[model samples]
Target: MRSLEIHGVDDLRVVERAQPEPGPGEVQIAVEWGGICGSDLAYWRHGVSGTATMRHPFVLGHEVSGRVSALGPGVDGFAVGLPVTVHPARTSGPLPERLAGRDNLHPDLTYLGSAARDPHTDGGFAERITVRAEQVVPLPDGLDTRRAVLAEPLGVAIHAVHRAGDVTGAHVLVSGCGPVGLLTILAVRAAGAARVSAVDLSPLARERALALGADVALDAAEQLGQDVTVAFEASGAPASLEAILRVVARAAVVVQAGNLPPAPVSVALGPIVSKEIDYRGTYRFVSEIEEAVELLARSELAEGVISHELDLADAGAAFTTAATDPHSSKVVLRLE
Candidate 1:
């Protein structure tokens, strides 16, 4: 089997590795496609994502879809050759919250392809990999693996909209038109927002945002004159947070959907205090992965979302395109 590993900043290599076998309650998947996420780009460019610095060489993919090649003992309700997408998170130990279906809240949760753990957990940027059967969700019939690979980041957008509560008939603003941001636009529109608008520094991203159903797309530099009832900050930049506060109506809801830096960020406090904006933070989803798959199954959301598809052997170039290409949305690596 071939694997893509990140040794350090700007150090990515494709190496051969022993094929993994499924363990009890696990399944081995022949990886079909995998999307390169922003976090993956961060790790490739700087050997870190937020504060999670790499402690060892790490695999660099989480948004993945594949077909089951083999199944281990004790796994049921799944068959070999079944197409599926995976939930990348796993709990380190049994926790009350995790057992109660709030696994994302578990303090010791490990997300694949992340360096948050000392010995980083390997990810799905490979020819084949094994994962717990419980983490795999079967793709709906006729759902292409290319679009199914988006379930991971689409789940993030779904979870953010879930945090926003009722968006029906409300004006919504999505600040930042990255993959997650563009998907957030689709999610918000599907949630029945009356008007959906987006902001991004990249014109290409803005254009894609509009194509994804945003009523209007604006550059981050432009002044936002209309006040929105709900705002989503999908860009981790501090400036995006500040901009949302300025454009949100009084008593509006603001969901911080992006992963911010570990350092404290200073922003104006008057609006939050006087306007009484409901500010919330959302983490990885619990059950929204299913919703993401369902949503993608119904719409053309995946049309422009995938910008490039490269072979697994070109993992380095794939990461470079994802990191530096302003027009690229989701860069997928085909393994099979």
Candidate 2:
């Protein structure tokens, strides 16, 4: 089987490797499609993510959907050839926190393709890979691989919206028009937000956001009036946090959903103190996977988010294009 190994910053190599066999309580998936994420681009460009860097050879994919090729011992109640989406979490220890469904806070949680691993596990940018049975969610019939590939990031959007409390008739602003940001737009719209706006540096991104139901798409640097009731900082840009504070209406909520490494930013203390803004943090999918999947499956159209598909062998090109091309939305690497 073929696998991708990250040797260093901005480096990826396709190499021959032994096919993995599923261990007990695990399943092997013949990867069908994997989505290149913004965090992957950050790791390649900066050589580090958050507080961790590429110290050892690492695999670089998390947004994935595949088919079950083999089942390991103790893994039952599932058939081979079933299409499924991969939930890339490595907190496999018998849970104290996550077992109750709050897996996001599991202390040993190591994300797929991230530098935050202890015994770093490989990801789904290859011919096949093995994962715990609980990490795979079976995709419903009639949902295309592209939509299944979206299950990971759209789940983030869903989590952020839920953190915003009630979006009904609320003025919402999404900072960043990347795949997750655009999907956040769609999610907020679907949740009945009366007014929604998006911000990005890319004109192409702004256009895509508008096409996908964003009421207004503006440049992040533009002056935002005091109308936004809730602001989602999804750009991962350091300044977007302060921007959210500056533009939001009094008593508005700000959900920092972007994976921003720690950086200092000036905030208007008066607004945060006087208006009592609810600033919250959100991570990956939590209790919203089923709803996000159902929404995607029930939508009448493609929802205008997934932009392109490339072969798994061209995963490097997909990352390059997604990192450099502002027009790129979700660049999915299609397998079988």
Candidate 3:
């Protein structure tokens, strides 16, 4: 079987690899679609994401969906050919007392496609792969692999919404209209936020945010004249985060969902002191992926997010488009 692997910066290759089979309490899947994530681009361009430097060649995907091909011993409630997505997290140890029930915050977590740890974990950007049965999630009925492929990112959006506290009927601002930001708009709207405003530097991103049900899409440089009760910083740009701090209403909730630079960048903090905003940070996700699947199965939220889909044979084009084209939201690779 052929798989996409990253050796170093600008060194992604499609190479032949032995097909993996399921182990005890595992599930083997024939991957159909793999969504290119910001982290993937980081690994491809700089051999690192945040501080997770690439140690060697490894598969490059976490957002993926496919059909079950085989189930290992002790696996139940799943059958061959069942549509599925995965949580992509494998907890290696116990959680802290204060962080109980939040598996995403586990100190010893191994996520698929992450180079965070030594002997980095491989991902599902291949024709076939196996994951522990516990991580495999059956897709909701009527949800195809194309949309289910977005469950991971949608989970990030949902988790960000949760971090922002209650947004029901409140004015929310999403600072960035990339794939994650657009999905954040869907999540906030679904959570009953009365108005959803999005901001992005890219015209294509701004336009797509509106198409996905944002009440209004603004340029990143503009400030919202009205009060923003909750704001999500989805652009990694430090300026965007600073601008958000300046405009939110007093005592508002601000969730940082985007990946800021690994190194420190200066930003104004006066607004936080004056307004007493609840500035919070959100990581990948928790058990929200199940909720994301249910939501995607019911709505067209992820439909407009897929701007391009290429076959595994054209993986380079897929990565190039995802890295260079701001207009392309989600660049998917059809592995099957």
Candidate 4:
């Protein structure tokens, strides 16, 4: 089998490797498609994501979908040839948070393909890989693998919506039109928002957001002109977060959904204190992966989102396109 590995900054390669076998309560997946995430780009361009630097070569993907090829001992309710998407998170130790059903808050959570830990765990950018059976979420009938591959990101969007808290009939602002931001718009709509407005510097992104049901799409420089009841900051830019904070109505909920830099960022405290706004942060999801897949399976959620697809052998070029192409949304590598 072949795998895509990141060795260092600006260094990526396709190398031959032995096919992995499933361990107890695990499953072997013949990966079909994997999406390159922003974190993956960070690792490729700077050899780091957030504060986590690459300690060694590791596989570079987490948003993926594939078919079951083999099942390990004691695994049931799944069989070979079934299509599935992975949850991508694993945690150990019985912490208070884990025991409370907030496993994502566990101190020792390991996200696949992440360089956050020493001896980084391998990801699913390979011809064959093994994962704990529990991490595998089976796809619903009629959902194709191509669309199922987006479940990971959609899970993130769903989690952000959950963080925003009861957006029903409220005017919502999404401060980015990237893949996650646009998907957040869709998720907000599905969560019953009255209206959604998207902001982005990229015209292509804005156009796509409008096509995906954003009531209005505006350039980042333009003022929103109206007070939103809820806002989601998905641009990962301090400036964007500031913009949202300035425009939202009093008592509005602001959910920080994007990954911000590790450094301190300046923000005015007057609005937060005066308005008594409910500002919150959302991490990766728990139990939202299934909801994401169900949403995608029922709608044209994948349309206009997947801008490019490449063969696994062209993984380097794929990463370059994803990093440099602002017009592009999701760049997926086909491994089958």
Off by over 4 Å in 2: 93-101, 220-225, 267-269, 300-303
Among these predictions, the greatest TM-score belongs to 3
lDDT of 1 by residue, 212-311 (tens): 9999888862366656989999988888898888778899999999888888988776788889999999987987999988888898766678999999
Clashes of each: 0, 0, 0, 0
What residue runs in model 1 are displaced by over 4 Å at the alpha carbon? 97-101, 220-226
After superposing candidate 3, which stretches have Cα over 4 Å from the reference?
none
User: What is the TM-score (0 to 1) of candidate 3?
Assistant: 0.98
For model 4, state the Cα shift of residue 79 in Å.
1.2
Clashes of 3: 0
How many residue pairs clash in model 4? 0
Order candidates by lDDT, high to low: 3, 4, 1, 2
Per-residue lDDT over 1-336 for candidate 3, one digit per residue giving the tens place of the 0 to 100 score: 999999999988999999898889999999999999999999998988998999888998999999999998889989899999988999986789999878899999999999999899999899998999989989988899999999999999999999888899999999988899999999989999999999998889988999888988889635687489899999888999999998888999999999999898999989899999899999999999999999999898679999999999898899999988767998899988
User: lDDT scores for all predictions?
Assistant: 0.88, 0.81, 0.91, 0.90
Tell how far residue 140 is off in model 4, in angstroms.
0.5
lDDT leader:
3
Q: Can you write out model 2's per-residue Cα lDDT over 1-336, one digit (the tens) per residue?
A: 877777777788888889999999999999888888877777778877677766788787888887899999999977999888877876757668434776777777877788776556567778898988988788877776678888888888998999889999988999988888988988899999999989998888888889878888888734678888998989777777777787788899999888776676554556677778888888786657667777778773335777778886786788788888766788888767
TM-score for model 2?
A: 0.92
TM-score on alpha carbons, each prediction = 0.96, 0.92, 0.98, 0.97
Please list all clashing residue pairs in model 2, or write none if there are none.
Answer: none
The local distance difference test score of model 4 is 0.90
